[model samples]
Target: MAFFRPGVSREAEVRHHADQEVGKSFGELLEKARGAEHELRRTQASRAGAAELRAAGLAFDRALTDALRAAEAAQRAAFGVKAYDDRIRRRKGVATPEGARWTAEVNKLRTLREENRLTGIARVPRPFAPAR
Candidate 1:
């Protein structure tokens, strides 16, 4: 039988997909934050003048705060969970027919394997197999 296995339900699959999308968005936001941090660091390191260094330091601080706030908001909006909270929960559920089909396919595979008592099947013959 195939290695495919019964998995999450349709509702669960939808929820999982949504969660993934939100995660990607959150990651993008984090990348922006990192860029801001890099800029701030560069400004501070430049030898142009003292005034420039001070300005850069201030901007860096503000950028840091903005990044943190953005992250918090994204997390709450995406997963409906607080950054400080130990546990997070999703507000939505999945609903996809494909999920159901996949689950059924997995169950069928499992049933076939049990009945056949087969470890595995391969198209290519083993080294010890007798030549035709």
Candidate 2:
């Protein structure tokens, strides 16, 4: 016999809608992240000023985080909490192919960030202020 909880169904329905929205956003977020990554690469190759490189890195970080969040949400929605947890445990936090790719990108980003931090070139001017 299933326990009767009137609120449970409503909560599940809301979650379903939220998941749908997240699924829809995954593609857009991924595209934004890709664009940010490209910009960061270009800025690095061009040996841009510290401010520009820092800005690009920050933008890429934000975009990548957003994309990863959306992807995780979609995966959880598709797999359910228990199954998703099991998969994550089995995979060691990389539950899907997209997750693996994102993880690689994150690793690369961290390496670049560390290199810049070591070189003292990741500093940025005040937000919305003119770069010196």
Candidate 3:
């Protein structure tokens, strides 16, 4: 005989990855990027000294690069989670609403990531990476 625990549903576990881990992390990173961009623009428009402007620009570039890298990681994780959910649905012959929502969310994140990558001017500073 087997007992089913309502608290330990597959959907709950999958939802944690889709919503809590990847989604929240990406959202925070996006917010940070936006803040950095706004600061850069403000500094530029304020007619600050060249040194101040340059410093602000550098800060913004670093923040944007970090955010983009984090977003890429989040996107990859989201894709993996979506694929896992799809596989589970296929194996169980069940289409979960949570899974559908997660797929849509993942697509939205992908779109945002692509748009940011295309429009952003900053490149990750390779010199900052740790040596192997």
Model 1 over residues 3-75: C-alpha lDDT tens digits?
9854546665564455445544545555664565576557655644555555555554454444444443434
**Model 2: per-residue lDDT, tens digit, 1-132?**
999743424555567568667867878987997898799889999999988988888887777777766765665455443333254443654556754665565465456445544553367656696669
Per-model lDDT: 0.44, 0.65, 0.55
**If scored against the real structure, what TM-score would every candidate get?**
0.34, 0.58, 0.44
How many collisions per candidate?
2, 0, 0
Question: Clashing residue pairs in candidate 3, if any?
Answer: none
Which pairs of residues have clashing backbones in candidate 1? 11-94, 15-94
- Looking at model 3, residue 78 earns an lDDT score of 45
- Candidate 3: where is the Cα deviation over 4 Å? 1-23, 81-132
List per-candidate RMSD values in Å: 23.6, 7.0, 8.7
True lDDT of residue 113, candidate 3: 48
Give the candidate order by descending TM-score.
2, 3, 1
Worst 10 residues of 3 by lDDT: 89-98
- The superposed Cα distance between candidate 3 and the true structure at residue 17, in angstroms, equals 7.8
Measured by lDDT, the strongest candidate is 2
The candidate with the higher TM-score, 2 or 3, is 2
